[model samples]
Target: MMRRQFFLLPLMINALMACLAMALTNITTDQHALLAFKSQLKLDPSHILSKNWSVSFPTGKWIGVTCSPRHQRVSALDVSGMRLSGNLPSQLGNLSFLASLNLSSNSFHGQLPKELAQLHRLRYLDFRLNGLTGDIPFWLGLLVELRFLNLRNNSFTGTIPSSITNMSKLQVLDLSNNPLQGNIPEAVGSLFNFYP
Candidate 1:
C-alpha cells in the first residue's frame, strides 16, 4: 500500500504540472495576438493598449483586455473610440477564446479580414463607425455563438447575406446606416419572434 500511494502521488503531481503548462501557453498566445494587433495600428491617440500592453501588466490587467478566470485566456477586448487607425490584422484570429470584441468609433479601414471568421466562440462584436469597406462576409454566419452584432455607420456595400440567418443565437443585429440595399432575409424571422 505504501508503494502504491507513492507512485500515485507523483502521477497526480505530473498531471497537475501539465495542466499548469497548458494554461500558461494559452495566456502567452493571447498576448502574442494582442501584440500583433498593436503592431499594425497606424496610430493610437489614447495610448490605451499601446502603453499598457506589457508582460509586467499581466494579460488580464492590460487595458481593454479581459481574460477567462479559469483558462486565463483573453475573452473580451473593448477598445472603442480611441481614434485608432489601422487595418484589422488576421492575427486576431489567434484569440480562439474571444467572446466579446468592440472596436467601434475608430478609423479602421479596408476589408474585414477573413481570418476573423476563425473566432468560433465569439458572442458579441461591435465594429461600428469605422471606415471598413467590402461586403459583409457571409462567413460570419459560421459563428454560431454570436449574439449581438453592431456594424452601424460603416462603408460596407452590397446586401446582407442570407447566410446571416444561420446565426440563430443572434439577438441584436444592427446593420443600419451602411450602403446596403435589398430586402432583409425571410429566414430572419427565426431569429426574432417580435419586431416593430
Candidate 2:
C-alpha cells in the first residue's frame, strides 16, 4: 500500500501543477484584454481607469472590476456614470467569464462590436444613455443567458430584431427613445417580465 501511494504522489502533483498553469494563463489573458480596452478609451474624464487599471496592480483589484471567487476570473464590470467617452473595443469580448456589464450614462459611441456575441455567459448588459448608433446587432440573441438588456436613449436605428425573442431568460428590455421602425415583435410579449 505504501509503495502504490508513493507512486501516485508525483503524478498527482504534476496534474495539479498543470491545472495551476492553465489558470494562470487565463488570468493573464484577461489582463491583456483589459489593457487593450483601456488603450482605446479616448477620454477618461475622472482618470479612474487610467490610474487604476494598470500592470502595477492586479486586474481583479482594479476599480469597477469584479472577480469571481470560485473561478478567480473577471465576472462583472460596472463603469456606469463615469462620463468616459470612447468607442467600445472588441477586446472586451475576451472576458469569457463576464456575467454583468454596465456602461450606462457614458459618452461611448459607435456600433456594438459583433465580437461581443462571444460572451455566452453574459446576463445583464446596460448601455443606456450613450451615443451608440447603427442597427442593434441581431447576434445579441445568441447570448442565451441574457436577462436584462438596456439600450435606451441611444441613436440606434432600424427595427428591433425579432431574434431578440430567442433570449428565453430575458426579463427587461429597454429600447425606448431610439429611432426604431416597425412594431415590437409579438413574441416579445411572451416574455413574462418584459418591459417595453
Candidate 3:
C-alpha cells in the first residue's frame, strides 16, 4: 500500500498543478477580455473604470465587475450612470459567464452590439437612459435565462421584436419612452410578470 501511494503521489501533485494553472489561465482570459472591453469606451470623464480595471492583477474586485465563486470568471458588470459615451463593444461577449450587465444611464449610442447575443447565461440586463438607436435585435430572444429586461429610455426605433416573447423567464420588460412603433406583440402579455 505504501509503495502504491508513493507512486501515485507525483501524479496527484501534477494534476493539482495542472488545475491551478488552468485556474490562472481562466483568470487571465477574463482579464484580457475585460481590458479589451475597457478599450471600447470612447469616454470616461471620471475615469471610474478606465483606471480601475487594471492588467496588473486579476479583476474580480474591480469597481463594477464581479466574478463567480467557483471559477472566478467575470459574471457581472454594473457601471450604470457613468456617463460613458460610445458603442458597446463586441469583445464584451467574451464574458461567457456574465449573468448581469448594467450600463444604464450612459451615452452609448448606435445599435446594440450583435455579439452580445452570445451571452446565453444573461439573467438581468439594463440599458435605460442611453442614446442607442436602431431596432431591438430579435436575437435577444436567444437569452432564455433573462429575468429582468430594461430598455426604458433609449432612442431605439422599429417595432419591439416579437421574438422577445421567447424569454419566458423574463419578469420585467420595460421599453418605455423610445421611438418604437407598431403594436405590442400579442404574446408579450403572456409573460406572467410583465408590466406595461
TM-scores for all predictions: 0.87, 0.90, 0.87
In order of TM-score, best first, we have 2, 1, 3
What is the TM-score of candidate 1? 0.87
Candidate 1 lDDT (Cα, 0 to 1)? 0.89
lDDT of 3 by residue, 1-196 (tens): 9999999999999999999998788777778777876788899999988778887556877989999998679999999988888878787887889999999999999988888999999999999999999999999999999999999899999998999999999988899999999999999999875666
In the range 1-196, model 2's lDDT, one tens digit per residue, is 9999999999999999999999998898789888887898889988999999999998889999999999989999899999988899898998999999999999999999998999999999999999999999999989999999999999999999988999988988999999999998899898765655
Instruction: Give the whole-model CA lDDT for all candidates, comma-separated.
Output: 0.89, 0.92, 0.89
lDDT of 2 at 115: 86
lDDT of 1 at 44: 93
Prediction 2 TM-score vs. true: 0.90
Lowest-sum lDDT 10-residue window in model 1:
187-196
lDDT of 3: 0.89
- Give stretches of model 3 more than 4 Å off: 1-22
Clashes by residue pair, model 3: none
